[model samples]
Target chain A: MQILEFLNTHMDMVYIVILSVLLGVEVISNVPSVLHTPLMSGANAIHGVVIIGAIIIMGKADPSNILTMALGFLAVILGTLNVVGGFVVTDRMLEMFNKKKPGKSKE
Target chain B: MGEYLLEISYLIASVLYILGLKMLSGPKTARKGNLYAAFGMALAILATIFLYVDEEGNKLQNHIWIFGGIAVGSVVGWLAAVRVKMTAMPQMVSIFNGMGGACAALIGLIEFPHYFGHGGSILILLTIFAGLVIGSVSFSGSVVAFAKLNGNMNKDIRLPFYNIINTLFIIAIFAITALLLVGTLTDPMYVYLLALISLAYGVLFVIPIGGADMPVVISLLNSFTGMAAAFGGFLYGNMAMLTGGILVGSAGTILTVVMCNAMNRSLTNVIFGAFGTGGAAVGPGGSGVEKSYKEIGVSDTAVLLNYSQSVVIVPGYGLAVAQAQHVIHELEELLEERGVSVKYAIHPVAGRMPGHMNVLLAESNVEYDKLVEMEDINPEFETTDVVLVVGANDVVNPAAKNDPASPIYGMPILEVEKAKNIIINKRSMNVGYAGIDNELFYHEKNSMLFGDAKSVLVSLVAELKTL
Candidate 1:
């Protein structure tokens, strides 16, 4: 398969992926337990990167095929919603956790 | 040239994502961290659409569909984020997370033909199948979780020999996947069937999970979706996608473990224990005759709180459900105004999600310093004059310590029972979410105040004012 040939040519890139993944997990391990929900939510939004793949497929598909077009359209919509909603909601939730000014009490 | 540009851009985005996650660990810098990560995402998307090229160096051309889809989705997502209440945040998370899974599933659906008919490797197929099964399961399971959390479905359905049925389903899924890999099942029908079966299995995976364990379930499903996306990344050979998915998968798994430890339940038990299923599995603590708890009027509670030198308030899902965070904050203020030092005790798993109670309290503008974690404030309970428990149960239950037979025996609790005098507000004698009777209620120092949390807090605030 042509696919393996293409990937085998880019075998060095796999190291980059492995390093990035390890670093990402290492950093995330430091987050406190309290922020877990928002963390999960924010990560959910990041995986919305699938929309990029969707965009690629939608662009190249035979524009006349109504079924492929519709599926691609739905994919983009759902993916974008996941990304946008995940970030915005996590931000809003985190915003609620601001520290009060030390001297300003009884607000 | 275009490929290099795309990779460099993704590298930049990945660094920003890592930086954002690092900053999120600190409370003061969390909002900034979210912005950084969002900026990273925006960079990845824009760069991909504008620069990435096919083997033939063709870029994406359907500008209208891309922008239109994003715009519509942006509007919908913004409205949902703005309108949702803190108490219902878990529900919103479940629904949105499910969308991510649906995206992965749909991607596999679209690309299946390329893998089957076109030149495709076994590696690609492996990744594709992983995405298909995981995505389908996460999507359907999250829907069930959403329904349960939103109160649309209350029962935890467990058909006869549920474990055997699930095991068989899993076995069949593997067999079918093997057939596909071997080219024995090239028909699109097999993939579609696999998706359908996985989707059905997803529903079953979550239906048996009890209400209290929903948070862990949510985290686990979130990880499932993330792994699916990782497989999607592998399918496309995309670095940014792979990194992001791995980050989510690991983080979600860690959080689920933390939640399990908080409940003192093993991860295995959570998946199979079926704590809230029928029979004696429902509630925690003793199954013996109940002792009558002393009831205190709202006025007495107000007086007790006002006179106390130090007071600790424990809040739970009851506080969230009644939307009483604002009133409770008011009560804290009133007590502090009278020179009574008021503090809050927050359990890790209090309310629906981790740190949710903290968010709820913060929404009412409670000071961060006043909100104490169970580990820190738990010790101070003994020296405190009064411990007011608002809509909390299992977290403060002594049964977790004294009753080895209790399901939650090993879970670390708030130790509110150590305080000099204990006061609790609840609608009635109904057990808490763990469906367990709180032996703390029957303690000699405990005085139960009956009413809705919001109204009761309002009454307590008024009484504090009169004092």
Candidate 2:
């Protein structure tokens, strides 16, 4: 929460976010078509940071806030699944692109 | 000192994320890049849990729930990655992406009560509501996409007044969002009601789209998830979250455009509506004549392929369906032994998901260098001795170029007809996923080899040995 206030007060982070979005567009333009699916999955994983945000908000409530806790708990689980599954699957897919060898077909 | 450590780690994590994205551009560096990005996520999670403090300087102590949630989700994700077949990749990607959207929506839901509290910045509340609407839409839309792809639901479901309803629904969402922004809507029910409405709208948003256009849909939903997450970042003022979300949103937008261009469809058409409701017949459509392609025996195809100086193989969803990548790799090597130049022609939208065919071919151990894309391989077909099209249809259709009345008229296609000889393998005359007949199949130089892709390739391998 202090970080949130710190960010709003400083105000520069807002510009940073906007600038980052443009910089990101530049970086993404270079991705090859062969890696596009993995690129989608990889970007999906990055958004999983919402899990941390949910957990922080849940901390402000007392034990009686079941709905908030449940929502936060579920959010954590879903976010983790996205991040872990997305990266692992992308890795597995990339590993399959082994360099083929020269010569006759193996029997 | 502890705070400084936390901030440093986050900075490092962001750098790693950017580095990972950069590394993923090439085939060789992609796996390591994935690892680097995963490590970045892990670091961010660890730092947040251990170092989080409230604005009042209270340290966070909720440990068990967070750890437990992470553990369960990890197991589920791990099992999914290990157990899923390569052919089911599109649905899995959609499902995982849906989870990301769900998390963003939940954040908006959890924070709604506080949004009305005094001193809540109007900007923050607006960002929160953006997350709620976009996140709900993306989550529900992705679920529908998954169900349709998995055959649990019908592939295309159309209703009357699609464009009218879609436009009105979007306008209503904006109106409600504007109302909420003014702080006049006090009841929490309004928020819940908005979420429900948005979810329903999302379902309607996706059902009208045809299965052939799903890869583009999935990529667009991913961008929605990213945009929603960025709203959360704005709510919390977390630079890492904001950076990650913006990166995803921008990248996804670019990919959606790329996929749209590859299919030769405008983004406006893809979004407002396409397919489904139109009474377009799905067939070997409108070539006017009862065209029949020449049928070739396995021995003849083998002889032709054996003596050819150059052969380009075109692969599509059918190749993935039959799991024929390895056999094709074997055929390529066999032909190479006889000194025939062999290469693969990959259509951008070849499989159900973008880049999916490349992954499948890689699984079969096809060399990265041998795989050529449509733009680079189109000219090569003119000089090529033969083009062996495997389980591919709409991509190679000359109708995209010649038939002005065809549904897929303006779409870009592989110039397989330009090759000296074209031999296509298929189990039957059924059209491909686009539900359109391939004119390339009936071209004067084209011949059909009837069989499953795997069986035909296996026999071709055997026949090549004889020559």
Per-residue alpha-carbon lDDT of model 1 for B8-56, expressed as tens digits?
9888888877788777767767778888888988898888888878878
Q: In model 2, which regions exceed 4 Å deviation? A: A1-10, A98-107, B117-119, B280-288, B463-467
DockQ of model 1 vs. true complex: 0.61
Interface RMSDs of all predictions? 1.7, 2.0
Taking chain B only, the TM-score of every model is 0.96, 0.93
| Best-performing candidate as measured by TM-score | 1
- Highest-scoring model, DockQ: 1
- Give the docking tier of candidate 2: medium
Write candidate 2's Cα lDDT for A1-107 as tens digits: 75588567857776867777776677778677778888877777777766777667656656678888888889889988888888877777776664343311342
Per-candidate interface DockQ score = 0.61, 0.56
Model 1 chain B: lowest-lDDT 10 consecutive positions: B276-285
Using lDDT as the measure, the top candidate is 1
